[model samples]
Every structure is written in C-alpha cells, then in structure tokens.
Target chain A: MHELAPPLTLEQGLRWLDLIGILAFAMSGALLGVRKRFDLFGVVVLGCVTAVGGGAIRDTLTGQTPPLFLRDETYLWMALLGAGLGFALGEGLARFERTLSVFDTVGLALFAASGAVGAINFGLGPLGVVFAGMLSGVGGGIVRDLIANEVPEVMYRRDQLYATAAAAGALVVVLLHPHVTSFQAQLGGALTIVALRWLSRRGWVSLPVRRVPGARD
Target chain B: MHELAPPLTLEQGLRWLDLIGILAFAMSGALLGVRKRFDLFGVVVLGCVTAVGGGAIRDTLTGQTPPLFLRDETYLWMALLGAGLGFALGEGLARFERTLSVFDTVGLALFAASGAVGAINFGLGPLGVVFAGMLSGVGGGIVRDLIANEVPEVMYRRDQLYATAAAAGALVVVLLHPHVTSFQAQLGGALTIVALRWLSRRGWVSLPVRRVPGARD
Candidate 1:
C-alpha cells in the first residue's frame, strides 16, 4: 500500500518528469543524426521524430488520430532543443553514465506506464497491455536500429534486458494498478526494470526460459 | 479524355498491373534489407515490411484495422523471395544504373496508381487523391531513409524526379479510371510517368521550387 493517495495530482512534478524524459530521448535522437553527419534541419527531424515517433505510431495504430505530434508540437520544439543541446553537451553526457542512465530510466518508466495505461483505457486486458507497454518502451529503439541499418538490439540479442525490462514492468503495473498509488507503482516498476537490465549486463541474473528438455546446445 | 470505352477486361488488367507493382516494390524492399546485412529473419521482416509499410500506414490512418500486414502473409513471402533473388544477384546489380532507373520508374507508376485507387475508394476528391498518391509512393522511401539515418532523400535532394512522377501518375489513374480501357489507362499513366521522369532528368527540366529567390554565390 502506497502512502500517496488516489486522485494523484498532476500538479507539475509528474508532468515535468515526462517532459525531461522526452528531452533526453530527443537529444539521443539528435546525437544519432549528428553522428550520421546530417544538416541542422535533418538533425532536428531525426531527434523529434525518434522521440515521438513511437508514441505517434502507437496512437495511430490504436486509432487515436491527429497524433500527439500534431497536437502539442512542443514535442517537436523539445526535439529541436534536444538537437542543439546534444550538439553542445554530447561529450559531457557520454562521460557520465550515471546521469544518462537516470534519464533513460525515467523515459523508460513513463513510456511503459503510459503504454499500459493507454491499452487498459482502450479496453484491453493484461496481455494486450503488456504488448502495448513493450511497444511503447522499445518501439523507438526498433526504429533507431532500422535507421542505422542494423538488427534491432531487442530483436536479436534475445538475452539483452531492454524490452524484457519493459515487459516485466508492464506486468507489474497491471498487478499494482488496483492496489497502490500509480506513482509508487510506476517508480517501483521502473526501478525493477533498470535493476534487472544492469544486473543482466553484469551477469548477475538471468531468465528461467533456458531450461529446455531435450534441447540441443 | 476522348479515347476508349470502359470494359471489364481493362479493369482486370489494371488490377494485375497493380499487384505486379506491389510484388516488385516488395522485392525492392527485401533487396535493400539484404544489402543492409540483416540476418535471415531480419531480412525477411525488412523485405516484406518495406513493401507493405506505406500502404499499411495509409490504411491505418484511414481506419483500416489490422493493417495490410495481417491481411495475407503472401506479401511476406513475396518479400523473402525478392530478398533472396537480390542477395543472389546484388553484385551484378550494382553496375546497372540504367536498369535501376527503369525499375524505379515502373515502381513509381504502380504505387502512385494504387494509392490513388485507395484514396478514391476512401471517398476523397482529386486533391486528396493526389496527396494519397504521393504518400503511398514516397512513404516507403521516407521510412527507409529514416532507418538508414539519411535525411529523407525526398526532402533534401530533388534531383531524382521522385514525388512529381508519383503525383503525375496518380492524376492519370484518377482521370482515366472511368474512361479508356482500365488497362490502357493504368499502363498509359505508368508510361507517361516514366517518360516524364526520364525527360526531366535528361532535359534538365524540374518544378520551379528553389532554395532561395536570390542568393549571391
């Protein structure tokens, strides 16, 4: 049971968190464009599109038209800002894994949570919600990999803890939706996901799916 | 505007042209995926997906559920064979700019015609049909560009006579739908489009849009 009560106020903190996460993701997108040696407009387009492309796609797929990109356009602005920001601060960001990790964690949590929320709102049950969450969290990565002409990290290296983290987080969200505060539930889920990924990277944990009867090595 | 009569046989031929074009486009997509060095499964996904992606997107935006990808997996197989064929002969293809250009012209004609057909069926007027035609033809390229981390070639460089060919072909498709033999209409439209592109490239002809009104060198 969370200490925070229902009617969770959207008074500013949560809003800002989502915004900052968008900003970070936009920067990441812009940085990619920069690495590809595109012009400024091209860089901005990549950043903005990569940042909101997943959400826009999910929305369109679910029949939510006009898309968030058309609605706020702030996401676009954020992406533009992100391009300039990335150009200026890319090296500093690369040097600090801790800070970058924090942004990545927040972005992952919001996207996954929102994806599940969106699914549940659309009258889908747990399984559908899980699928949506996974899409939301890692859809951009797939797009990113596709642009870079590489196999999607999540699709190939099955042992990688990226989309798996989001899937686990989404499942937890459904379980906790009725019992606790959305904030705590979200934070807890996000932490769990990030922790799992970090641990996996260090070989501190693994899945039980490896146990196959009569399986060839 | 004053040529032939409407006939069932013509309509049948038009459909064949459209489907053949779809298969051709699918093949091109698969070829691109293979060139990008995707694994077998990844290649198949790219091949089938790039072929169907734009139309699927147009369908979804227009409220066609499950999109075209779920309609028939035949498109998927089409892409796989296309990719395999390209993989087997890609080295030989690299030196043939003339053949590539011809194929590109045919693809533009087919895609533009089909896209117009879709939009008209959706009950849009001429302008909407025009937009639909361009989107259908260029949307796949846009997606490919984004994934390949290239500023969409459609936007940055207009030297290839890309969107214009699609729009002109679409005009012919819509204008001739009820008139001349459907086969004649479609094929004529396709031929006209190819001629326009080739003429523009060879004669240094282009639309009037330019970077700036007056800029000193």
Candidate 2:
C-alpha cells in the first residue's frame, strides 16, 4: 500500500486501457444501430451514448457532477471516432460478434474497476461500491438495448456472467485496496473480471435460471 | 420575477402535486410489474425505481448529486406505498389502462415543470433545460418499460403526444421564467403539458412518423 508514492507506469497503462474500452463500447453501439437500420444521426448518437453512458451514471451516483466526458471533450472525440469506424465497417463488424465481445468485456472490466474506485472514494459502503461498479460496467449496454427495443442481454442472457463478474471484480478491489496500491488493486480487479468473462464465454462458467411455470417466452 | 418574495401558497400546492405525481408514477410501475408477472420483490423495486428514476437523473444532470430521494427517504416511502396499493389491486387495475393513463399524465406534467425549474436554477441554457425537463417527465416510464422488456411507449406510441408535451411544457417554463414568478411559470408549464396530453389523447393532435423501407417493425 504505497500511500505517498504514485504508480506512474500502471496509471498510464490503465489510462490506455480505458481509452480502448471506450472506443470498443462506442463502436459496438454504432454497429448495433446500423444493424437496426437507424438513420446516420441515430447511429452516431447511440455510439456516443454507449461509450459514455456507464461512466456518466457512475459519476452521477457518486455525486460527481458534470460528468468527466462533459468536462473533457477528448473522450467524446474518441467515442465519435469509434462510432465513425463502426458506421464505416457496419456489416463487416456485425459478422464478428466475438471481436465485439472481447472489446465489450475490456470496457466492462475497466469501468467496473473505475466505478468501484470512485464509489470507495465517495465513502460508499461495500454494497454501494459493488452496485455502482456493476452499473458502470453494464449501464451503457442496457441503455443501448433499450433504445434498440430489445431485452438487455445482461438481464436475460444466462449463458455467460456479466453483472456477477463485475460485482466480483468490484469486491476484489474493495478487499485488496488496503493491502495494495490503487493501480494494483484496479488492475487486479479488471483482470479478475476479464478472466471470469473469458471463462463464461468458453462455457466453463454460467449462472443458472430457474424455470417459471407459465412464463411468457 | 418576484425574486425577493416567495409564493407560499403556490409552493405548497406544487409540493402536493409532486407527491401525487410520485405516487402515480410508482403505482404505474408496480402495475406493469404485476402485469409482467414479476415476483413481489421485483414489483416493489420497479415501483421505487419508476417513482425516483426521473428525479435522480434530472438532479445528476443539473449537478445536484446524491439525489433528493436518497437524502430524503420520504419519497421512497411514498413509492413503496404506491407499489403496495398497485399490488393489492393488480389484475383489477390492469383492466383500467385509462385510469392509469390519467395519473401518468398528471405525473408527467408536474415532473416537467419541476425539472425545468431545476435546470433553470442550475443555469442551463434553453436546450438543456428542455431536455432535462422532458427527461424528468418521461425518464421514469422509459426505465420501467425497459425493465419490463418493452419499447418505451413514449418513443413508439404516436397515439398521444408524451415527450413532445413535456418538451413544450419545459419550453414554456423557460420562456416564462424571465417575466413571471417562478410558481406562475411552473404552473403555466404544467398546464401546457396537461392540455397537450389531453388534446393528443382525444386524437386532436399527433406527431407524424415517416415510414422507412426495409426497416424492421
């Protein structure tokens, strides 16, 4: 726990990862919009929203007003670029859900770590931290799906762990925060979520759903 | 603008209206949850979320963090009570969509007025104020529908003017703020929205939708 010293290298690495995650998220959103046959304006809007939605929700929950993306336009630009790329690549990108999944997982992991850290700094309890982290990881996707008029995959898709993985990652960060540097804890948390996502994708892990009698399909 | 004097009577009236709106919104959410056949816990959660979601989002956007409901649990209690009432009259209430619509309209109108006032106080420009107001009015319903796995009625249903009415109401508040008292402006705004809703519901007003070929319905 290096309280006085800053971990410059890890911090830089995390920043790069965060940017990549944002780009991936924005592109995924744009791709979905294109597939849905939304107009050009709608596609761009969806991309930007997906890229920054989770972080905005997290900031709002933690009492951080104005949101980071609004203050710093660089993130918005990155999201726009991702959206442009997605719109240009449109159908080609749609064919590779695996690639999209990888990027989405990256975004989810980093957001979970960052969201948890923000909540912790805001003096939130463990439950609040976990909830914030999970929301930050999945909020964008939920909004995207909602706009697209589909069930949010995170809520219904039991084939792979999404929110659960995020909660676990956030929990790890909270547990390890006192014993390690901030960068270390965040990195560890992100990796843990990534591992869980990968395992779930490979069918090695999944959450169970109980059958409800006479439920609508 | 009556900056130096407070309109105590109008303020009290607005507070009561806000409470009614919250209760109506919560019950609407609970009714939907019941119709969806969600568990009792899910019904309660939906109700609470629907009641508070709009206000929370508006507060966050306006830089008023921690949200009003979190700081004041009275709103949450109202939401819970609304949910209880909705659950107790589940199937019977489900048969009366018209009754629900009237309450929803009241909620929407009041929320629009308050949200616009909040944005104006926060020093947002006209566009931001209108957006915040519209979101505050329609945001809760959108979340409720999303959780229930349906397209937000505000987005798709053209039978009545919902978002447009809220936006128009917000615009009225923004326009009237400079010349009128706060209470007067808000009241004017709310009345404008309610009027629009009523007119639209009677099929006297509706927005036009252009059809796109090769688009999924």
Candidate 3:
C-alpha cells in the first residue's frame, strides 16, 4: 500500500447511496413501529434509530461523542420522510417485499462501503476499519431484532448475506485504499457487494460452510 | 494519606455490605421486569441488564473486554428470582414504589462504590474513578428509561440526588483509599450515597446548584 493518497471523490455518490440506503432501512423500521401500534413520534424515532443506530454506536466507540444526529439533521429528515411514506403505504408496501428487498440490498451495499470509508477517515487501521464497516452496516438490524424480541438474523446459522456482504465490501476498500481515489473504490466496493449479495439471493453464489472430511465439529 | 496501613475491621464490614448490596440490586432489577409486564424470560433479561449494564459498559470503556456477565451467572439467577416474585406479587406491590425506591437507593450506593473500585482497579485516578462510580450507579436506570421511552429522570433538573450521591460516595473512597481497605472505602462510599439519595427522596437533602456571581447563562 502507498503511504500517501489522492483526494477522495466518493463524496456525492456516497451521500446519495447513503440516503437511499438509510431511507430503505427506515421504512423497515417504520413498518415494525406500525405493527407495534406505536405513536407517530415513536415511529419516527424508531425509524431513524433503525437507519443509523449501528453507525452511531461505532462512531461513539471511536470517540465521536454525542454523534452524527447531533451534527446533522439531514439523515433524520430522510428517515422521517421514508417512515412517513411507509406509514401511509403500509398495506400496499407488504405486497412489494421484493421491491423493498432490492432497496434494502442497495442500502446495505452503500452503507457497507461508506462504513468502511468513515472508519478509515477516522484513521482506523485495516482490521478496525473492516470491523467498523460491518458494525455500521448491520448494527441497526441487530438492534431492531433485539427490540422486536427476535434473535438477530445475522447471528443465525444461515444469514441472508447481510454481514458477509459488508465485510467483503470493507475488505475491498481496505485493499484499494492508497491506490485509488476513495470515491472510485467505494463505488466499486458497493457494486461488488450488491452483486455478490444479489447472486447469493438468486442461488448463484453460496458459502462452503459444511465441514470437509475429518473436520472437527 | 498513609500509604502502608490497612483497616481489617472496615474490610470485613465492607465485604458483608457489598454482598448484600449486590443481592439487593439484582432483586430490584427483577422487580422492575415485573412492573414492565415482562414474561419470565423477559423478566430475567431485564433484571440482569438493570443489574449490570452500566458496569459492563464502564468496563468496556476502561479497556476491560467481554465483561463480568460473560464470566458469572450470579446476576442472572438473582434477577430471575426478583422477577418471579415481582410477577407473582405484582398487584400487591403497586403500592410499593416507595419501598422500591428505598431499596434502589441501597443498590445505587453499592453500585456506585463498586464502579469506583472497578475504575481504580483498572488504573484510573480519583477523577476517573469518581466518574465511573456515578455512571455505574445510574447507567442501568438510564438504559431502563430509554427502553421505557420516558425522559430519563437523571437528566432532569430535579433534586433526585442520584448521581450526586454516587459522586459523593466515590469522593469519600478516593480520599480514604490508603487508610482504609479497598472494602472499607467502598462501604463508606456506598453508605454516603444511600444516605444522600434517601434523604433527598424524603425532602431532607437538596442541592442549590452553587452559582458564582458571574456565571454564564
């Protein structure tokens, strides 16, 4: 890896993808709030938390106190918009789980890339950055599962390529760092993750988790 | 500060108080679960979290990974017992908020002292230890309030004396660390917190927010 680097260019792309991804995540959170019959205020809070909870935690752990919600209201507004739309379209949205899944996947990809980017920006080494990226991308989902009183899907024996995609994307960023503008690398990383996850979903790709002969349990 | 001497009697007294205090705190956590209308499983989880969440977080920040819950089942069982009693005797205990508060104060005192001790054990000085103590005592309550969706009582400008009690107790321990066994100092600290918090609840102790003449608005 080169010791010096050029300027990062993924700013606009990252922001747009981040927004889309967060909005999708927020919609999912809103649906849960609706199912719980929470008040509108609760729905908004829950939606925003679902969108950003994990990243917020990762940032805090890295010493970004009080965190992004205190720094910007953009994400909150985006989540609010998504949740508001979701509340109005709750029944209609259920029929389009396929469409929602696509959006969720896009969000996952963008977040995975950006999570790594954010961690690297904070000067974390490769391992820490990769961990932070995965944490940021999947943390909200885990929190949602916990509150919903279900074990987090990512922790189950067969996950839907959620955390794995994030880790892969993060690894890509780590490898490409110092060799490319952060933007090109992030976009490439995001697309790679989405493609991999999409392929996994379509049964075109699968992990070889089964033990080989004589392997210890 | 005498750097070499120790107090044997104070150490023994402290040991007894710490044990009983832990039991009391764990019991209170179980009772909280019952009030939340939790099932047996929910009750146990809530109780254990209430008993240890703050301490665990504090330990994490202090660079102690994995935390005590990963190592011990004492809190879990205690919480289970508390929750069971609370669930079974819930209706009859509605009028016991006052009693709960008193018990909570005792737990708070112990928790505060323990937090201080833990921080000190982890190499923090007086200031950090005092802060840790205060956080440990009220951290679980804050988490409980967040989940319950109420404004945390500790954040309000009330004369609750919760954190204040913890800080006072921690200060006592810090000041007397050398002359007393770690146990004695901790006991003194816990008693100090309990006394202050209980007195405040009964309208006996209150702070006036000591202000300087030129203090900024």
Residue range A81-168, candidate 3, lDDT tens digits: 8878766665566777787788888888887787788789999999998898888888888876655545777775343576888889
- Tens digit of per-residue lDDT, candidate 2, span B1-217: 5477755786787777788889989989888776766555456657877998898888876767777775555677788799888877776666677877788888999999889998998899999999999999989988888788887888978888999999999999999999998888998999999999999978999999888998876
Ranking 1 against 2 by lDDT, winner: 2
- Order of models, best lDDT first: 2, 3, 1
What TM-score does chain A reach in every model? Answer: 0.80, 0.92, 0.84
What are the TM-scores, per candidate, against the unseen true structure? 0.55, 0.61, 0.54
For candidate 1, give the docking quality class from DockQ. incorrect
Task: After superposing candidate 2 on the true structure, give the runs of residues whose Cα lies further than 4 Å from its correct spot.
Answer: A1-8, A208-210, B1-48, B61-63, B68-142, B146-217
Best by DockQ: 2
lDDT of 2 by residue, A120-145 (tens): 77776665677678888988887788
Candidate closest to the true structure, highest TM-score: 2
Model 2: colliding residue pairs: none
Q: Docking quality tier of candidate 2?
A: incorrect
Least accurate 10 contiguous residues by lDDT in model 2 chain B: B36-45
lDDT of 2 at B75: 75
lDDT per residue for candidate 3 within B1-217, as digits (tens), equals 7596666675566545544555455556566666777777776666566667777766665656566656666555655565566666656756776776676777788878888887777666665577568778877766665565444455433456676778789889888787988888887898888788768778887643322234343
**What interface RMSD does every candidate have?**
8.3, 5.3, 14.4
